[model samples]
Target: MSKFWSETVKRCVPYVPGEQLNDANIVKLNTNENPYPPSPKVVEAIKVEAERKLNLYPSPTVDQLRTDIAEYYGLSKDNIFVGNGSDEVLAFSFLAFFEAGKPIRFPAVSYSFYPVYCKLFNISYEEVKLNRDFTLPVEAFFQTDGGVIFPNPNAPTSIYLEIDAIKEIVENNPDQVVIIDEAYIDFASESAVSLINTYNNLLVIQTMSKSRSLAGLRIGFALGNSDLIEGLTRIKDSFNSYTLDRLAIAGAEAAIKDTNYYKSTTREIIHTREWITAEMKKRGFHILPSQANFIFVSHYNKQAEELYAALKDRNVLIRHFNKPGIDNYLRVTIGTNKNMELFLNKLDEILA
Candidate 1:
């Protein structure tokens, strides 16, 4: 470690994202990115904005884009907070709501970024263990000392918690902020955003990367009561007034408006996920019931690391975490139908 590094940098353990390969022939599925391209309207809007003004700085508040997202979710602009990405919004939230000494609670196997944020911000946290079935033990989050956060349709396992259970957690923690990272919510049943109006302490963060096919543009937003939104805004403005660029704002506005296009794409991914699940079961894989666009699975006879290496050798990539309690499982993102067929055919060969 460098002697010049601060205490925060010294203690931080950075999150390792999924492997990103540059090979054109690889069937990439390690990251849960949308398989389809963004809507045509998004591209056109970006092109128009690109030609308008290249020299001037973008809007500091990003007002119009916030309005568009608010309208899409039947909320007012005051209830919205926009950032460069969901990760940034989440970072700002950790700084805004959670305290240094108070311990927060989150699912043990949920998104890896939560712990990273806690460490970076010097916040105390407890990892709430999941049930035997890998489902969230909702009551475990009741009355946290600091606050609570976890993904709905929890990551890596792809097990979704119902909105009723989320409401229970929120109601139980009336004094603490409950942040729901709904990065993959478009592929799931329902959103906790509908309950934001009822619960003043709830904040629901979402991204355009998965459902709207805008990972390249990096647009994410949060929905909550006006007070919570103002808190996030304060944290953001303190750091960077212009968190998003003009192109991103334009593209996101177009993306949120093109609801039908994303809905069709989301349906297609869900269909592919179900088909792949059935195929994997036929090949002796034990899979979880997934509500997200990815599936968590394990083989009856093979080690996860061995399977991961074998697939990588064949120009196919999937995620296999080396952590304890889940070393045998793999998280596979739902690709296109053709891509999935190739993956399944390769798995058949491996199993044989």
Candidate 2:
């Protein structure tokens, strides 16, 4: 507690990222990162850019990457914006669109960063409780006058809502900004980007960190109407004109363009997730139907913290959040098939 800290700084509670342990032999599945390595094309692109452009700043607009994303998603460059990471993009969004005095609304069970962002920006917010089964309730959002945000296939719980349900919420509240954080949308059935043409207030945020296997490069983007993108751009330009380095821009563009590689990897991960879910259910664990690259499960007989400790002792790590309703569950990332088999075997041993 330094006396030099400003009042606003003292009040801020930063988001905690998942642990990245250095133990080489550990089966790391805590973070919801892609288990496969990034496409070889991404590495080649970075190498080419690194050789020639160490002295110059990256394109401030990130025009080429923006155009690539726009073309991929069938949107205009005016509707897309990029940032250092989805977290920064989210920060800019909270500052630019959700600072109104009205209380912002989101799911009680969602990405943990939402509360941190609200506190960091000093915006008043209320949690609209998820339904009895952890699904988002469309009616819970109808009474609110403020902005709305929630992750699709909502995190920690890994439950997904249909696109029609999301459109109902957005169309119902056309006046307020409704942000859909889709960091795991690639694994889901549908994306909110499809609704952007109809709902001007809809802002869909995504990141390369999850599906594209580029978390190390730190690239993320937002898709919305031109006006909303402009607002985010204003906040970003005022903060850092060159949030992405040259290598990042090059690598991300390459990754986005490598459609075959990205699709193949995601398919494999989804397959692994299904197998893992079936096996866990056989072991008497209640597993949520997940559309993301992770599964949320809890056993009726074993405590989550106790299982987490046992797994850690065996050098296999998974995420266990001690938050109120979800304290008994473990959120396990979909790892390679071999890794998952090892995890299940170790769990059987620990339980025995």
Go through the candidates in order and give the C-alpha RMSD of each one to the true structure: 0.7, 0.9
Q: List the residue pairs that clash in candidate 2.
A: none
- For candidate 2, report its TM-score: 0.99
Candidate 1 lDDT, 16-67, residue by residue in tens: 9998889999999899998899999999999999999969999999999999
Candidate 2 displacement at residue 173 in angstroms: 1.4
Q: What's each prediction's TM-score?
A: 0.99, 0.99
Q: What lDDT score goes with residue 189 in model 2?
A: 90
Q: Following a full C-alpha superposition, what root-mean-square deviation does model 1 have from the true structure?
A: 0.7
Alpha-carbon shift of residue 21 in model 1 (angstroms) = 1.3
Clashing pairs in 1: none
Question: lDDT of model 1 at residue 331?
Answer: 94
Find the 10 residues in a row with the least total lDDT in model 2: 138-147
User: Clash number for every model?
Assistant: 0, 0
Per-residue lDDT over 1-352 for candidate 2, one digit per residue giving the tens place of the 0 to 100 score: 7999987788789888888999999999899889899999999999999899689888999999999999999999999999998999999999998874889899888998998988888888999888878989887776467879999979988888898888888887778899999999998899999999988999999999988998899999999999999999999999998999999999999999999998999999999999999999989899998999999999989999999999999999999998999999999999999999999999999888
Q: Of the candidates shown, which would achieve the greatest lDDT relative to the real structure? A: 1
